[model samples]
Target chain A: MKSIRIVSDFNSNQLIRLWKNINNNIKFSNNDFNQVYQEFANYKNRNDITVFWTNAQRVIPSFNDLLEYKDFDENVCYDEVRNYAISLKTYHKEKSNISIVPSWHLPLDFKGIESQNWKFNYGPKFIISKMNMIMSEIFSQDENIYLIDSEIWFNDKIDLDINKLWYTVKVPYSNNIFLNSITTFNSILDGVLGKSKKIIILDLDNTLWGGIIGDDGIDGIKLGGHDYLGEAFLDFQKELKKLKRRGILLAICSKNNEKIAIDTIKNHSEMILKKDDFVTWRINWDDKATNIQSLMNEINLGLDSAVFLDDNPLERDLVKKALNEIEVPDLPLDPTNYSSFLRSLNYFESSTLTKEDFARSKMYKENIKRIESKKPNFSFDRWIKSTESKLKCIKINNSNIERAIQLFNKTNQMNLSTRRLNREEFLEWIKEKNRFVFLYSLKDRFGDLGIIGLVSLEINLKDAMIVDFILSCRAMGRNIENMILSHIRKFLIEKEKDSITAVYKKTSRNSPILDMLKKSDFEEITKYTFKRNNISIYFKSDPNIKFEEINDKN
Target chain B: MTIKQIVYKCLDEINLSLSDGDKLNKSKDELLIGDGGKLDSLALMIFLTDIEKNLKNHLNIDINVLDDKLMSNSNGPYKTIGTFIEYYEKKNEIN
Candidate 1:
């Protein structure tokens, strides 16, 4: 079973009950808010993942305490809390398998008739913002520290019965809060464990809209309007679009005539998702299972990475039976509940944002041209060269930091060490005088594939250590990896670095890069470590592709 | 609604998870809740709340099936389906 130890400030014994059927969860002492770091240190060597679940009230000064001190500076509490959080982060810097859940909720400053002091009313907001700042600071400082925001766990009012539960059970939360927060709570666990899905295989017809496009025609289909039914479908499509922008590949699999479906997607005015929005489609009369399989193969994604969503129960069952690894969620009877059901599934719950995420849809859109270019004569090498790809290698800066971190999180198949760095850790690494990071963006004849690769190296005298090397799957086969290495070699030569060393960390899904270091002209010095004695290897880009080196203006 | 109809409707809502044979012997005067209850506390709560929601939707009237008076009384209204119906009938009369 998955192992997890939770060190919480409040009495979170209910979490054990919530996750009883899931992982083996161990809860530490209650009301030991100040002893979190001590507990974390004790379990730092344990195999179980350590989670620091924080509540806003734990760090914020209680009103009772504030009243006790007549002349206290307000900044004292904020600074003290911030310093305490920073100390915890500093103690665990560069540590592995640690998760920090930042404070999300502060009891609302009730502006009732009892007291209407606007000055004191802003205390909760101040605490909330300060807690958020602490969380973000810790998140950036440590690669292993995953931040789970508490606010996303609730909506509108804080989802807690503090008064009743505090008096009776000392838990400070009701059953309703536990029930509602379960998914978000589990999503945080999933995020830390890297157990998130990558691809979404969508169904058309009743799935995306009210009716079948083949039967209703293009304009006749119901989507995006004041009508409730249409609005439900429209909202669902909007959610899918958001996921697409966040680097989830959206593919179409349906049992409709290709022409009719394509026409509807291309011409339907009410449709929120256009034809170009999808990475690929198998809009034919074939069975959905077969189509989904082909789509996964074409996208170079595994079945486990794909989520199939079809409104029809029979179709959902068919795909579920055929592809057991692919997640096929049961759609609610009513379309109005579609978006909520999908959101609750937590298929794409990621903790960090990178520029490549926002540009993912555009990158996939560029793939269509590559796929089409190989239709008549299928030659992978020829097609890749004919694209006339140009590589722009630039140092990692503010402009490309998001994409760099995106590559760190998303790139699996071509990652040398598979080391994921959080935003702050990444900034610190690139900012070091001895260490340098390069963010590579590729542009082909078709379009710009935004920031596809990242490489970080730590220089020590005449020797260099490859800290990170990752290339996105979309830009994998086009010799982009080789080009990145070539650029790195040039940099090393320019810096008068004589030798380079790299380590290959193997993961279940990263077998594609197991022998990458060996293939990249490095000799195996140890089990995972490799060394290249001479840095005089002559490097050249692909003949058909023109390469450029972009300077960081930022 | 009549006493027998109210009991039948409440049983019908809970019947989603129950087998037909299990629910066959249920009657208006059946002891379905509280001490020696056929349903557990959670199931009883769900059944009562669903009945209240369904009744409000159908009749445009709200009734608290688990009111403080019903719980605090020596022999509460929830002793049987018949008692529940009688309690609601008297409360509706007051309203």
Candidate 2:
């Protein structure tokens, strides 16, 4: 199980109350102390800032009782505290893992402006801003930290990432640091916040209007634009369209004749949503979950990320109770209040925002491009040759080891064995005198594929066990795997290590890797075990395979 | 108008007249998702949408009633028109 440490100022009771809601599995510590060193060990070992229950609870140590840099600066207590904290940090030197800033410090921006009034009895906003600044600093330093700015977390009201915003917003949080890691809660929050939902599985009849679209006929249905109830629904549809524009994949999963709903979405221009807005359309009597399943297969997103918006509470409850992971937001009784009511759903918050985030749903819209592009119009081999895809095959160096380990843990597909190794475990394995770690950075014509693949292995000089060989799904279908294996084989030939072995581990989210094994055509020693120790040193270069040098200098 | 009248009105809108016996049986937990108890999320979405419009028309009560606690409680107030009426009455009484 992945580990995270929560650092919060919640009294034991307050922490326990929210503990179950946030994470049932996370380990939490409720320690209140004036000394930084006393609270530094666990915070230094695990992931940063799990949960901080700073309900006006954080107090900066006496400004007078701190340290200075020079030795034996006995006169100034402030000097002593500062010096000691610095010494502890320097002695630890970049080992500070999970971190929290004391409430007293100002969040000094890059422009050097003090963000909040530091001298005043600053509320939770002080810590929240401090956390944001620190995260901004840490994320810049390394890519490992996926900073979810707490200010943006709860409607810009309670910046959970910042503690002082809580005092201002009156939002008390039980210190759950693993909120972003909780995918269901996060997805729901993301959905409600209008962050990322590809498919909006909607209902028919009363959902779209007052009566069933089939039973009531086109004019009979109560939609927002034309009739009284129709106006309210029109408001609802307008809100749905806004979400759709933000790259939310809209789909129809209703129990209605396809023609009527189609006519309404298509011909009904006064209607808020058009037929083209939804990437996938499923309007049949099939079970919503089954419809959802087909939609998920069609769109290729985890059900956990999709939001099912229906008018019937029963249908919502069925999906919620059945697939607890998929977010089934409670539809408000008042269609008129939907615009504001949807505002309150927690899953709508954007946790990690990158430029690529906005394009996922459009990519869903362009899934035809995604599929058709997968099969190159220029023909597979020609496309592979035309792009002149260069593979930068590099041996693991000290500077890249941490990133390599991260890729090892995170890369799902093309991961031969899915062997996840933390830094310590990886370092120990590397020092074993028999292991090799290789990271591949692929760059094609479109853009740079950043550190797309990695393979961690252990060979007894004569034979090797491929512990992990995973590549990102982004780099698939590029004949990339063929080139990666080619490099490994050539390296093995140089070392005279014969009979290389590999394993394929199965996971629910990773179906692409199964294809990787089949494509490589490995000799199956057993059901899931495959081995290929020898490749012809003179193996005819299938003109389909294009290879190039990946020297560190380049 | 009392929540009971509103509940009956809601039942009327959905075209399902709740009997006094069925009303009594309508506690929060047994509300199905799609049928009488279970509302297809679409129907629940539509049902809530219509209910809001009806509430505004008759009761003039502008309340935001669609959310996790409203529908997800094992004994959710949103479960039945009756339970919802009780919740509305209680919430208004507090207000």
Candidate 3:
């Protein structure tokens, strides 16, 4: 089981219990209070996550001097922050494990006039914000380090019940703050595990706009004019557009005439989302559940990766009953509350963004184009050759490591072993002798589908094994699967390895990998293991696709 | 609500955070903080703070449940739910 070691300045036994209530698989380990530095230096687990949290005053006692209006040296605070960052960096360099640290913030009841507190250099708020900025700048460069924004957990009212609980017990925060912080931490963990939702299936009519397009013609729909309700609907659409830019695919599942809806979306002067913004849609008079299923299939995504939004309660109920795995949030009664409600859901949390994420919706649109181009009687080879696809093999490095890790965790169907790893673990694995990871970015005449495949190999003397073979579903068809195998075989041949083997572990979603392996002429060593000798010339690079390799100086 | 009802309602709020094994009993004679108490030192503080907040919200009565009088009592008012309710009634009368 994965474990979390919490090193904090305050008592965290309660926090451990709260986390356990949320997730049972994780084992939480708490250290003594006020041992943040000691715990950071002593922690040795390379496989577990460690969290370091501290009150600024507690960690740097000199800050207390400033708090009490006594003489204080700002250099002391900077020196302490530097020392802490050094310890964190040293620990990370040695262990290469994930570490979470909450940014420093003043207590909720800290008495300071807003105008004067922020203006003075040595004010508590000023000092804490500066320290937090320095800490974030230093920690964010490390891929394995996560600096949580603690302010988001607090409100205008005091979250820390200092009068009632601070002195008697070490717990400074109220129950509500603890619960909210734990929820945010849980969602971050979900994002790290690649469990965050990817797509938003939205309904038209009352959902995206103020009225049904069937009854209210294109110009009659209330959206993006001087009207308050129309402005609210427009704001909601803008919120969705922001989410779309963050790599969450938007899809339409409306029961309306396709021409009218598409026309409205294309020509509506105030519409925030255009036709190209959506990856795919199913706008027919069919059950929303079936439409959603068809949309997911068309994009090669699972139901769990989607969140459904419908203003109609009956339609929401039907979809909920039909697909329990998909998330269908209850829309509030008022249109103005829609944007805030969607933001409150926190279903699309991501640890970081990459180039692939910025262009995800466009990539899906390109895939759909490729799908639509195929004729019913077209041969597979002829169709693939017509696309003029190119696959560029890039070595995994600091620049592209984040996307590589994302692909490793997110790709399920085309994965060989379905192994999951965080940034540090993945980097450490690749650093070992005779281990190599190569990422492949595919593009066609339609568009550039960003880095969508990852392959890692481990060599032992003359024998080599493919540790991970993951390809995004967007690049699954078009002979890329066979081309990846051929590339692996060619690389092994160049390395003078005698043979290469792949073990297909059976997962509920990984049968596609097994199917591809069986078709590639790998001799079956066991029911799950496949092997091909170096002398075997059964697999060949696809002539329809051009391949290039770029080596990195690691 | 009466003092006893307010105390029980506060306990119900605290119970939501407690595990099944650590939940506080709602009976009047149940021990709260001293010997045989369901709460540890941390839980005891949270329980008292929750009661204080709830009392102010429900009755507009500002009282510190952890005052020195209760701490100094040889047979503390926090021994059982009944004793705590009696102490709160006396404190409310003083207010």
Task: Please tell me which predicted candidate would have the highest TM-score against the true structure.
Answer: 3
lDDT leader? 3
lDDT of 3 by residue, A1-554 (tens): 88887778888877776677667788888777777777777866664677776788788777777777788888887878778777877776676467778888876678866676776577778898888877888887787788898888787363455556767778777777777878777777778878999999999988899875644568888999899999999999999999999999999998665777899999999999999999989886545666777788788787899999988765676677667789999999899999999898878888899989989999988886322321222244554566678999998877889999898777766788989999889877877889988899998875798998999999988999998999875566457877888888888878888899899988755766887888777888889899988635656778888898888867
Clashing pairs in 3: none
Cα-based RMSD of candidate 2: 29.0
Question: What ranges in model 2 sit over 4 Å off?
Answer: A10-13, A20-22, A34-43, A52-198, A215-220, A226-231, A317-325, A348-350, A368-554, B1-95
Model 2 C-alpha lDDT per residue in residues A1-554, reported as the tens digit of each score: 32334334433333332434445554445445333345554434443333332321132232211111123222242333344434334323344333332222222111222464342323224333443444345344443233443332233221233232232222233123323224433443334334564567777666666665543456666775546677877877777776666556678788655766788677665677777777776775434655666666677667777788886654565466556668888877777776666655554444445556567556777773322112111233544565556677777777777779777776543566667789898788789777777888877664576777887777775877777777764465456776777777777778788777777787533445655566574677887787785654443344654456555543
Off by over 4 Å in 1: A1-3, A24-48, A62-72, A94-96, A108-121, A155-159, A162-164, A179-182, A225-228, A358-554, B1-95
Q: What is the C-alpha lDDT of each candidate?
A: 0.66, 0.55, 0.80
Instruction: Name the lDDT of candidate 3.
Output: 0.80
Tens-digit lDDT track of model 1 for A1-554 = 44455667656665544454333344332324355556645534442455566555554454324434344455676676666567556544533255555455554333323332334624545545655776577567566676655665555343332343343334555344554455666666666566778778888878898775643556667898778999999999999988887888788997665676787787778778888778888876445666777777676667888899888765676577667788998889899999999887877877666898787767766764322211211343555566678888887677677878778876665678878789988777677799888888888765687888888899999899988888765565457777787788888999998999888887644544654566667788899888888787775645666678878787
- How would the docking of model 2 be graded? incorrect
DockQ, structure candidate 1: 0.04
DockQ of each: 0.04, 0.01, 0.28
Q: Which residue runs does candidate 3 get wrong by more than 4 Å?
A: A156-158, A368-554, B1-9, B24-37, B67-95
